[model samples]
Target: MAVRPPVSKSNVFLLMVTGEIESAEFPEYDGLYCNFSFFYGQDWTVLSNSSEGITQTSMRGSSPASNFVWNFPIDVTFKSTNPFGWPQIVVSVYGVNSLGRDEVRGYGSIHLPVTPGRHSLDIDMFVPEPASKLQKLVSWLIGPRPELVDPKFVARGEGREITRVSSQGFVRANVNIVMKDFSKQGYRNGTERFSNNSS
Candidate 1:
């Protein structure tokens, strides 16, 4: 048997970039990416490779182990671009099974507006664990101090903390939502704050 990661799991490959362009007028290329490990039967590490694009990146079952799902993710950053036309960004991923089979894929493409603004996407990095778990563990040992965004408020329950972030963001330390405990607390008097839905 061969060792492999499972599907139905998501690992954040890249930070949540505010914005990225599908294509640019000057074409500022970021780079290629990979999620699977390159080394096997030894201590694994941050495996990576440099390539022009996926058109040249290849995978084969003949290797000691094979990729079950060739699908990886790519993200783009928009430095500058023309004003007239929007360009399309294309991406694709495939996989092979033990029986030498390839998975059907969709020709992924994105048409980004030329106008400058913010954008975001869920990048995929095939680490063996969820991105959050990796962060908590590595950050502690590797001396990574999180940005520490101003938490509006903190409420803890059963080893879980609900933080109301400054940007009206609410993060549940636990991923479950349906069973989340909700409540209404009265302001002890003039401790009231007002907010509007208008951005």
Candidate 2:
């Protein structure tokens, strides 16, 4: 298991996903059409105080953003709309840890301008989840598995990555990726108002 920063009451951390389609409650599992599973630690508060009637707005520019400005529970999936039509295909997380330290981490964003239709989103168990040495050895012996990636992506270091695509008709972008150090517990974020506008 990846070491987690110690937990305490001094912090109120959160992870915000800036994407297209304005905003959306993180789907636990979309089944098949678009299965986006929560891959990392489930404790990162998505909306510190998210409640019904809380307004989430998006203004798309270079990259689409579905910014969450509220807080909600750990298991609840909050849903909102992309003011510009299409959803922010890319996703990342920002939050603070139990220590009250501010931090930002990036995960690979998936974009499929082609390959129409929904795929599957699984809470990626390959990374952060703690496993015994035997389990790791067995998986290694089982050979490798194909991973997903966004073709238009550019790595920005510090776990940050970005991708862009022009509309080519009838394709819906679905991303599912776990960033390095995502849920390492050592990660933290400074809580402040963020804009969905991308650079």
Candidate 3:
């Protein structure tokens, strides 16, 4: 009889994410819309190419009930050998101004939940402010607002310390996470660690 060889399994783990950008609360803004995109580390490979999307414009409702609803769907999968660089969703909110031009309202980002389950996130949003009084006056008069050259910068920590920003609003997200071969690689999910620490 010939001896059988043991098969080697791949170490790569898979993460599946499905969710929705439910709504937003921008108290000082109206006629709002949003743009969403993903940012991941080089170690991660997205199985699905649905990396970006734009939400339809929505106006805020009356006082005590001012929510801009998008209900935009988000579905993506990622494969990675390590968790050092988790995926993050970045959201940029904009509003139609009096001039009928889109002006950036806020920017926010949140890391995908590490546990394999449902997660609800409230992402606080902010907008860049003018550096000086002169710049503020010029922006108010010229019809352009201060905004990041690349909104993806919100997902990163570099060069953000010098940027001045003000709280604009918050976005709500509901995500369902599924993982395969995650624990087989001897990795502890976030929930597991949380429980362990609480004990």
Candidate 4:
């Protein structure tokens, strides 16, 4: 009889994400660009190099109510021993002003879908507002908009309550998620077991 090698158990699971930052609606803005990044827990390790990128500047369409189209691609893979900290994508948009400087227009974030399949997310974007009228006037004169020092702060709930922000616009994203060994790791949810077939 041939002896069988001992079976090895692996706890790691893979999360694959492929998507694009499709478009945005900034009614008053033109000549827009975007910056994107991921925020994940300590347990997660990125397996792909498409972690962060900047999109080319896009001008608003000629017609009224036309959105800025970037179609920026997103492809990333992550491996983790546990799902304690799922990943979230953070997006910051900027517009070229009369001074030709990039001024932050909006900030938004969305948690990656827990299930493995295609997902479309419309992230509501907001911009920090000046706390006082004097501050607002100064910013308007100086061409310095109220912007976050660290845009990733959008991903976290802490300390956000203290900041005053105004709704500016929204960004659309399309993402396809694939999971490996998720069920084998004893993590199963009603939605997690669904088929990958897009409806």
Candidate 5:
């Protein structure tokens, strides 16, 4: 009788983020760029080579919508103890200022699918609004807000262009990913950093 080798417990998955923003709320009209990152529980992996997230889809003209695809796909290997519990994809949009400072125009997050297959997702962008004195006072008295990014900025609709003045409307984008799941791979969790987009 021949003996069979045991399958390893870890799983590998490839992640791809498609870039698009139907509309973005900005105080001024200027060129725009986007950055993206993937977070698993507490641990995080950037989709870019620089400390900042991946730089992509630069809009030269004054426009709210951007449709560009990030050619690079990130490969991540982790323990698939609970495959259902996948991470979240966070996106940050920035506007390039004349002074060389980049201001955050919007932020958003989308849940990643755990099942191994190609999936398409629509992620809505959330733009921050300046708070009133009373709102800030009340929040301070109660306690610090939970999220680093304000929750009130979350857009209500998906793939719609926002044109409200007070609301400083938001936008949505599409992301397509082909997640290839592999078992018994040589790579292990914590063995090495996932990848550097620069390389």
Candidate 6:
């Protein structure tokens, strides 16, 4: 018998970002709210904008710490390709202002699951800290410290941090990822079957 190539299993990719974000730089000591946006790079489109379209947290007053809890779940699909090559989830954090425009505090990214299963990552939010004039002058004369920027925070096609004259602030949080395999659904003579039948 002729040898046959094994079938590749198809998987549905789903990512969820659930965590608390602590603010340190913003002036609002109390009565602070935040919103988050998720981007998967140019190649992919974000499905269903997670819960409530976008990740918007309720107004959380500052007490022990300036923190906001958010739940952002996204559904993504990719043609047969290596999961490792998929771009990381770009999470842009912003502070809601009352007068008008929202302020961009900082940004952070996390790697997706390499395999077809649930995965999780604990990542600290990175905010930029302003540098002194002398420090900037010296850096301009010489070179900047590579250690100041974390690779995870750098988005694809974006070279260097948003602000060159700044350092990173850390806010601890956990990121969870859950992958579903919808391809394994029962099939009968090319027709799909559902667990809960309407007819």
Question: Candidates' TM-scores?
Answer: 0.23, 0.20, 0.91, 0.92, 0.47, 0.47
Q: Which regions of candidate 2 are displaced past 4 Å?
A: 1-88, 121-199
Question: What would the per-residue lDDT of candidate 4 be over residues 1-199, giving only the tens digit for each residue?
Answer: 9999999998899899998999999999898999999999999999976899999999987987899999999999999998987999999999878888889999999999988779999999999999999999999998688889899999988999999999999999999988888877877744543642221
**Pairwise lDDT winner, candidates 1 and 6:** 6
Q: For residues 120-166, could you state the per-residue lDDT of candidate 6 as single tens digits?
A: 45343455443577765664455332233343445555555455523
lDDT of each: 0.24, 0.26, 0.88, 0.90, 0.45, 0.42
List the pairs of residues colliding in candidate 4. Answer: none
Per-residue CA lDDT of model 5 for 1-67, tens digit only, reads 9889998644444444443333344444456666665545423343433322455544434444534
Error of 2 at 36 (Å): 13
- How many steric overlaps does candidate 2 have? 29
Q: How many residue pairs clash (N, CA or C atoms closer than 3 angstroms) in each of the candidate models, in the order given?
A: 3, 29, 0, 0, 0, 0
> Which candidate number maximizes lDDT?
4
Prediction 5 global C-alpha lDDT: 0.45
Where does candidate 6 have its weakest 10-residue lDDT segment?
A: 190-199
Between which residue pairs do clashes occur in model 6? none
What order do you get sorting by TM-score, best first? 4, 3, 5, 6, 1, 2
**Who wins the TM-score comparison?**
4
Poorest lDDT segment (10 consecutive residues) of candidate 2:
27-36
Instruction: Candidate 5: give the clashing pairs.
Output: none
lDDT of 3 by residue, 1-199 (tens): 9989989899888888898999999877788888999889999998875878999998787775779999999888899998887999999999988888889989999999888779999999999999999999999998688988999999999989999999988999899988887776778875555353221
Which is the better candidate, 2 or 3, if ranked by lDDT? Answer: 3
Rank by lDDT, descending?
4, 3, 5, 6, 2, 1
Question: lDDT per residue, candidate 1, 27-137, as tens digits?
Answer: 111122222111111221122332114432343334433332223333332211111222233333333333444421212223332222244322221111214766768
